[model samples]
Target: MRLMLLIRLIFLLLLNGVVLSYAHAASLAYEFSRVSNNSTEDLGRQLSMLVTEQSGGALFTFSNRLGVPSSITDIYFDDASQPLFSSIAYHSDSGAGVSFDSQAAPANLPGGNVIGFLAGFSGDSSAQSVEGGVATKGVMKNGVNSTDEWVSFLGLWANAGSFDGLIKAFADAHFRVGLHVQAIGLAGRSDSYVNQPSPVPLPAAAWLFASALFGFIVIANRRKV
Candidate 1:
């Protein structure tokens, strides 16, 4: 009985640790999709992404897909999201991203084919990065009845504070940006993109794995009894 009790305690602790890890994860984890299909650029393999915080700003990364090698990236955005909230932050893993060129404006802006920046992210810990950024607010067309915004950062100058400072820097730049150009892609593909929520399943897998383990342990415990 005591052994079972101790096992339960450890199991609970392990589950709690996993939950806490995600709760305070410094990485800006999210699922995103195109806000609209009205893109002028052709979309390729959806670039898997990660965003996180640095000393005064945030960082990002692009990959071929989850669990696969990191891929090069070039498109980003300063979405018109209000408050620039980030419960998490992350950087890229293998290859960092950069701007191929700078000529297009964001979607909500006066001139541009899309609503994204020409910037990309590096590995979460890379020293290579772009500086300065832009943020849009409730300007992206999210279909017939919705609107949205985005935040793109190279190296935002913060007020010398912590994570909150990062958020503030973006909030401070809630204006239309000029000359970001469009993200590079195929000759006939659209480079500009908008954002909508994505329904990824990776994050939930942790709990599923834990439950499986718990079931296995219970079975073994009953067998021993």
Candidate 2:
């Protein structure tokens, strides 16, 4: 029994190492911060309407909270809508040692969503480009393995530009996305977060009713306390 317990504890520790990297990495618990729009292509006539559709999912960024101090390896995102990506056109106080990796399909993600993996952040990452629904993935050029908490990557959606957005329209998974931080530092722990779109604004009457209901609940809770 003692031996088995020891083994189990060790296994848990290993699991923690793997998952915690993501946990601490929840981009520092913010999941993704909304960044500005990227320069969309000019397709003349957008072959797909997803470029401007609300359900198509908007552009967001995955950044590190503690990554500046520690090492970072890659960034992963899961979406059933077949997300699109563009090249790195902007950089400010971002991770220096990293470069975008090829967009990969999700091996373990659920909901038939695809996974995009940008690897080699600690070394001279290769060039990155997006083709066939993936981004630029090249070989290491001369990465300095720079690290910082401000390290961030684009979710790469909402890329509608003068080119009429994109040649194709992507049907995102109802405006929901799973942002994942993976394999950072020595432990290689990871964490996954599912982002739900904000609720539509309620009417004034509905808001008033909700406020009254909230007041009643708060009073009741106070009494109980």
RMSD of each: 11.5, 20.3
Model 2 ranges off by over 4 Å: 1-59, 67-95, 105-173, 184-187, 196-225
The local distance difference test score of model 2 is 0.32
lDDT of 1 by residue, 1-225 (tens): 778877976787687778655543445444334333334432333443344555555554333332212222223344333323332223212222322222222323222334443222211112233424432122111101111112233444323435454334433543112211122333222222232333234554577567766876797687678
On TM-score, the candidate that comes out on top is 1
- The residue-level lDDT of candidate 1 at 62 comes to 39
State TM-scores per candidate.
Answer: 0.42, 0.30
Which 10-residue window of candidate 1 scores lowest in summed lDDT?
Answer: 139-148
Pairing residues by index, what is the TM-score of model 2?
0.30
